[model samples]
Target: MFALCDVNSFYTSVETVFRPDLWGKPVVVVSNNDGCIISRSAEAKALGIPMGAPLFKFSDFLRQHGVQVFSSNYALYADMSLRVMTILEEMAPKTEVYSIDEAWLFLQGMEKLVGWQEWGHEIRNRVQRETHLTLGVGIAPTMTLAKLANYAAKRWRKTDGVVVLTDPERQRKLMALANVSDVWGVGSRISKRLNAMGMKTVLDLANADTHLIRKKFSVVLERTVRELRGEPCLALEETPSARQQIVCSRSYGVKVTAKDEVRQSLCAFAERAAAKLREEGQFCRCVTVFFRTSGYDTGGEYCSRQGSMTCQVPTHDTRDIIKMALSVFEKIWLSGPRYAKAGIILGDFYHRGVAQPGLFDEIQPRANSEALMQVMDSLNQSRRGALWFAGQGIEKPWQMKREMLSPAYTTRFSDLPKVR
Candidate 1:
């Protein structure tokens, strides 16, 4: 059997973890640029603030309705996610982290040991007890069905927080009730085409002719349909492949009122990306920096800018990435406009410890490039932050502010929130 475990209102839940005063309040987590609602608490959902709805569009309404808003605190959220996953790892034998807030666990042959439904409840209860955040769990024979069951648990079985689709009849009812668009891989475009062909619900698509689907859709979609019907087409990767690219970005606490601040922010982001690249055992040939002005039309002037640099030699060196990112910022940073957000992206990556022999120069090892990186990594890890980079300095006054952020409830000992 397969199980899909999803965090309930992950972003908002992360914020509420430390700020227990937010319990039962209408809370919404804003997107990266503080642009829109990405995740909402149950209270916010009850008030009908639609997901992905632009913050500017409903700012007044949110204020009037007393909705608690928060900037996305990825540091707090990621640490909490790690704690949640750690709890699950201790309980489940085999688990795959699907995303920041979701994981799939293989639970084959466990039904005899403990009934699947009761086991699921125990898992959910344990998660809540350990981490305050609740989970919605779905169990089925296939990954697709597990995902469907998870969604049903969230949308319909609100009180149960867990759902199991072991019986064929039960699966059929869920498929009929769920729209085709809500299926795992079916995006809006595919959903529209399938709906046009009179396949509006998941059951219709699942029962549709396989040959016709292969002719219309790709082999991948065909496999998804079969997987939806209870076959496990994909096996969880034991060691999931490393990320092809890495991005570190954030909406400024306040609009960047000047070009120097923008460049500084970009440099800081690049430093983070470089550290992540080394952490993942990867190096990049190209780095890109992007910045955008606030979406809010308080408008004196607004502009979005980006620049990229390609290195002759791919390196994961923080110095190299930061220099390239700054160069990119030089091209993009405009003096007059107030900028809202900025990010650094490391792309064209290759595995670390593998250096390409330069066409111009023989592959000669730098005397201490790798050693320097190791020292830098160790220093940062030990200090829990940048210890040597006095050159880059702390963020500027106009930088992104997480003023209302909750303390690190799970990761940092000194900063952990106290339970009342």
Candidate 2:
């Protein structure tokens, strides 16, 4: 059996972790710059403040209800996630970290160690005691059921934070109770199509004819249904690999009018993408740059282009990626009118040492290239990021600003502010 463990109300829980007084109070974490509501507590949910609702729209309502609001503090949440993962690693002999706030433990051979229920309770209690973060756990023979069990535990099973869906009878009952769209990997479109076919519940989808389902949906989704029926179609990976595409994009605080400012935004995003690729020990052969003006601005030019530049040598170097990205930005540069956002995407990825060449460019000698990358990587590792760059900073003011950012309560030493 594998157990799926998830932190309850992750962002809000992280805030309450350090500030115990915030427990049981309505709390909502906002997007960067306090733009929109991103995560909310159970109390906040009761207020009917929908997710992604702009803060300005409901600011008075939230304040009137005495709801405590926070700007998203990723540094604090990330550190807490790391701590929670560490606790799980020590508790479970073999585990897969599913997300920042979730993990899956392989409990098949641990029957002799302790009762599964006891072990699950101990894990939950210890995390709460040490980290002050609550958890919901689900155990099952398959990942899909494990996910479903997790939802059941977190949503309905209030007395205990753990649920095991190992029995066939119980699985059927749970599937009846579970929504079709709530089943793992099934989205709204799939749910609509399934509902039209009279497969309106999780049990219906699970018990559907595999051949018919496969004919209608793709092979991958059909496998999801099979997995829901107790067949393990997906294998749990020990370490999640880097994504096929790495994107770094953000809207500027103010619209950029000059070509230099657009290039600046693109350069910054390219550097961020390159840093991510290097962090994952990966490289990209193609870099794509794209930009557009505001959607509402009818008078200005609105354009989006996905331009690709092949790497002379596949690289994770910010210098190389930035040069290619900036070159593409120059190609797409528009004068006079302003751009709202620009981004860079790194695709056609390979692991750090994996390389395949094209006919036009001469390949670097493996020994020299490896040595050079190793030295550069070492310098970058030792120093803080951006110790070296491809060129000077793009000639523009730093227009990216988080105007309503809160104090770095738990992450930074200098930015810490008085709570009361």
Top candidate (TM-score): 2
Model 1 CA lDDT for position 205 = 90
Clashes of each: 3, 0
User: Taking the tens digit of each residue's C-alpha lDDT, what string does model 1 give over 85-115?
Assistant: 9877766778999999999898866767988
Clashing pairs for model 2 are: none
TM-score for candidate 2: 0.88
* Candidate 1 whole-model C-alpha lDDT, 0 to 1: 0.83
Stretches of model 2 off by over 4 angstroms after superposition? 157-159, 296-302, 336-338, 351-401, 415-420
**Candidate 1: clashing residue pairs, number:** 3
Per-candidate Cα lDDT values, in order, are 0.83, 0.80
How big is the positional error of residue 41 in model 2, measured in Å on the Cα after superposition?
1.2
